[model samples]
Target: MGISKISEFDCIIFCVYAVEYRTVSGVAGPLVILEKVKGPKYQEIVNIRLGDGSTRRGQVLEVDGEKAVVQVFEGTSGIDNKYTTVQFTGEVLKTPVSIDMLGRIFNGSGKPIDNGPPILPEAYLDISGSSINPSERTYPEEMIQTGISTIDVMNSIARGQKIPLFSAAGLPHNEIAAQICRQAGLVKRLEKTTNLLEGGEEDNFAIVFAAMGVNMETAQFFKRDFEENGSMERVTLFLNLANDPTIERIITPRIALTTAEYLAYECGKHVLVILTDMSSYADALREVSAAREEVPGRRGYPGYMYTDLATIYERAGRIEGRKGSITQIPILTMPNDDITHPTPDLTGYITEGQIYIDRQLQNRQIYPPINVLPSLSRLMKSAIGEGMTRRDHADVSNQLYANYAIGKDVQAMKAVVGEEALSSEDLLYLEFLDKFERKFVAQGAYDTRNIFQSLDLAWTLLRIFPRELLHRIPAKTLDQFYSREAASH
Candidate 1:
């Protein structure tokens, strides 16, 4: 029998072989326990019928002989042990996916909430996807331009890489995530040069966005932004509102990634999956663990948090012979801005690298507010260079970083002593610092820059320092791009 028919609990039997247990021994939060159950498989789907005939769906979290614990997706607030009936469907939870899922919005439980027609399933995929074989996986090399200078020029994100945004509360991580979704696309390389504007086409790209435990305002903001920017046509959104059941948050990302995998591998489209506020997801895991009475680890979080996160992150990549690829950009808000928090700490170990959003930069009115010092993309080197971006891309990036580091140091020194006490070279470094933050790092929310535009702006800031002081840049590259007259006094 189908899930649609099973939802109507009036039927005595969901399936011919399905067993019904009227003995619900316990109901704690979203979990319900069934005692004296037999032959129930792990992860099996269950339907609970209340006294009023209302039905809720659940999955077996653990099964031991004739006892099973099921996690109810809709929560068990009013469920009574005496009146509740648990029906085992003998099937696992599966999400229906189709190419038409683009432009559609789904709730945390994978149900359509967009007021659109129900999804005509191309196939029902298990949310727990199979891990890709290591031998069959291909290395990521092609760069995906986010149109944000801080990301594209400095820490480049390659296709099929799993990179995350590290932010804290009160930051504009949501805005940044939305901007990237609207502007991200493949940067077609033109003839061994790093100039991205001359001849490049945005590839056929798709986005699967999942928002966990976000408020109504945030949800509407994303929906409106996607629609306004015309990106909704190529995007699929999964929203788990703040009032949604905590258990549903745990299933949201899996459904999103499963849809992404289908779109990437089956439809031959480059899919970008953006999961925001993973902190809420982790909280939900902790809540479930607490309900299950499992032993708590760091900060009352489950000890298996690292392995659990990996199951989601490792799903993003390219198979050797597949025509499409899946890339992930997960955003997590660090509690109290602690980088060492178990959430981001464990994430750092599993993912490629992280992009840290600084609160100070945000307070300074910087658009992206990304702190370049602590942020890095481990896969950047493989995706940029001669014939990819430009031959001088690497050297220019290094020089920019080196000069910025010195500029910061000089700023500290200037604060210690008056500006007049500093030398001319130190004064020039300070000027470079201002231009870097204003012209290079800071851009309008909607302003999208090509790789060439970003590099040109970098050169403009670099020219503030005398060529003699540019120790990080090679002499050959200096001759090609540096003009003697452009150097400041």
Candidate 2:
């Protein structure tokens, strides 16, 4: 049914093994081959058709003009070299995309992972979408409420926006990722570990999740987390594992965004794209740049690393005339717990804001482990509402922040200058800082609170502080939310 050829190579550099193929008619058996071509222009990559009739795409590592090298994208498992066919496509790789991809799971290369049904060939759209026009962009103003007191009150992740989770290894970054995706828009209410999912709208939002350079256990963990939380039905996941060649990690996010663009722009759907551990992707880029013999920048990272990250991150936001939006949350674990790492640093510059998962918070058993002070959403004000969220959300957040900041200063000065030297009222005021962190900063994920309830709780903590301590709140605001229970307790 197909033609065959013989070719040789100097060496083979393996790419990722996206998935296995088996045709219904047995026309394409499990395919794998070591195929190469003879040329210098094509020395970098090769296309080897396996016995199963599927073509494998990859790059060439070592080469001679008579026998150029080839790197197979798919793992070589079932085929021999003599019968394999190698050809050149004359360009970088591209992935297929379409609305039909909504309910499907894809590998880094855009191949179906669930293996349930074949996607219609005609429905494919190229995955390498061009940069969205700047003039066509609209401000990302809608607030995305996570119901986590820390995030809502401090960082305030806006809807139609792009924000990331900056965390360390062993932190609950993925747990937070799952919580956001599950509650996103549908859940009428959310607590730390629980959700009133039945009260949520089914089509409230769609999730596009991409996991790069992860392992089997991590993959299953995400799958189980989503499925158990009832979010699997509306979510699309793309996984490129560490076992896969480094090349796959580089392409994974692009493929994920391409699918998100189609769902958002073409289908009029609001899509939230979540990528975990961008650090892995960065490492992959470094590896490729090294192989390509390019000069390096900060800590062996590609010099264009900043622009490379911007290319992926800048894809998030609302587009004018496009009824839908692409909001992003990319998770990255900084090496050595270093915030200055190039990945997180460049990411900070590109995204609207960041949600930092602190080690101190984790030690205290806080579910989200959010570090309130450093976390911020530059687009928060436009998303909140007087009635939809709380009439006092604006003032309450700013005042609580101002008070807490002052509280920290008071305690630090007290530690240095001696607590006994301070007045009794100052001692009580200093105690307010501890109470704020314990009560508001720490809450279970399953713990549910409406905006008013959360605001009232803030007022409860503020009762411990002298009203003048809240510099951000106007005198009028304190009078409105001030509780009378201050003296009795």
Candidate 3:
């Protein structure tokens, strides 16, 4: 049978070949090169039986006539080249998905790890998700309130948007990711502006959190935090440990996205997928590329790294006729705080916008530590307005950006020249910088603020300066929201 024809049939039925070959020629890293194999299709799952009775699972990476190369998911250690037997399943990797997956935990390869029973799957979907047609996409508009002031008020994440978090090594990105999982939801209505926190509705919202190459401590933190806060029931967690096989890391995100797509399209749930430390995923890709002896791109990463990332990020969006949508927040740590690193640099191109975590702000003990100047949400404007968030959102966001930019510049100048050299107005901006950082950007990790609370807090901070100083605000908006209470006090 032709391998291509076999693959087509494999998609319909479980194709398990009874023939087992002992023609394994060599083992290198995670790859097992088999010679004299017959018609093994690319990406077909295989069973590698060791000299012992145990069997390991693998996927065909390459096939040339009668020769095939397979990547073992459990890694290639202690396999006798002559005695090892390979069986081609003639099918690609697939995972069982169900709505019951909520609150369950799975490993990188979609195997249960939480001692839960097997999912009664409605369907088994290929982990390599199909690309969304561009013509079928609906623009992301509804806002997803994250409850963090910096993100909610400044870089707002829209539903169906793919926004990334750019962090440095040793930062609190995991904590932030967990916090978002706890507090994220869509606003039901702005019924009353007095207490904006009351408008959140998460009954239809679910989080698919996949942590790749994370340590035991970090994984436990995520699990414990979700459990203690009672948000685990609506979350589907996928964990890949630091010691997991490198090949598994490459598959972890695809499996997670497949589950997300199932939840969004099949079950009609608004799904938010958070992928932590994507740098680890890229590193795994580089390792696999090296084993395949492929040519490297920038910084030794695979040339197809960009294409690979696009497959992940592009899966998140609103389909034109679908009832539910998929939003993504991919967190990647830049090596040595370098924003220009291949990981963050290419991510910037694919994602809607990024929330940059500043090392300097973190050093100063600012929670979330967002460097607002560099952080942006390109879809923020479309999501927040008269009916969506608030009429004052655009003006307030712009004013905050303008004033903060000026305050940062003044603070930098003060550092270069002595503070005594500053003019009176300059010193006022310095004080604004301090208050803005402490009150606006910095908050307790568990402290959750809704969109109205965030905007009200912004107005409170803006009142520190005269109206003329807040030139970004329009005359009508200033007359309505601006209060002179701070100046009176």
| Candidate topping lDDT | 3
Question: TM-scores, in order shown?
Answer: 0.94, 0.80, 0.94
- Model 3 whole-model lDDT (C-alpha atoms): 0.90
Query: Model 1: runs farther than 4 Å from truth?
Result: 1-16, 192-200, 484-489
TM-score-based ranking:
1, 3, 2
Candidate 3 local lDDT, 1-489, one digit each (tens): 665545544556578647899998888888888989878999999998998778899999999999998999988887877778888888899999999999998998888899989889999999998888989999998899899999998998888999999998889999999999999999754554533445457978999999999999999999999999999999999999999898889899999999999999988889999998799999998998998899999999999999999999999999988888999999999998999999999999999999999999999999989999999999998788776788899899998888888898998898899898999889878888899999999999989998888888899898888888888899888887886652232
Whole-model lDDT, model 2? 0.72
Candidate 2 on 243-359: residue-level lDDT in tens?
876667877898898888888887888788999879999998787677556699999999999988988988888889988788899999988889998999999999988988899
Q: What local lDDT does model 2 show for residue 394?
A: 85
Better of 1 and 3 by lDDT: 3
The per-prediction CA RMSD against the true structure, in angstroms, equals 6.2, 9.8, 5.0
Clashes of each: 2, 14, 0
Model 2 residue runs over 4 Å out of place are 1-46, 50-54, 59-72, 75-85, 90-94, 98-100, 186-202, 448-450, 483-489
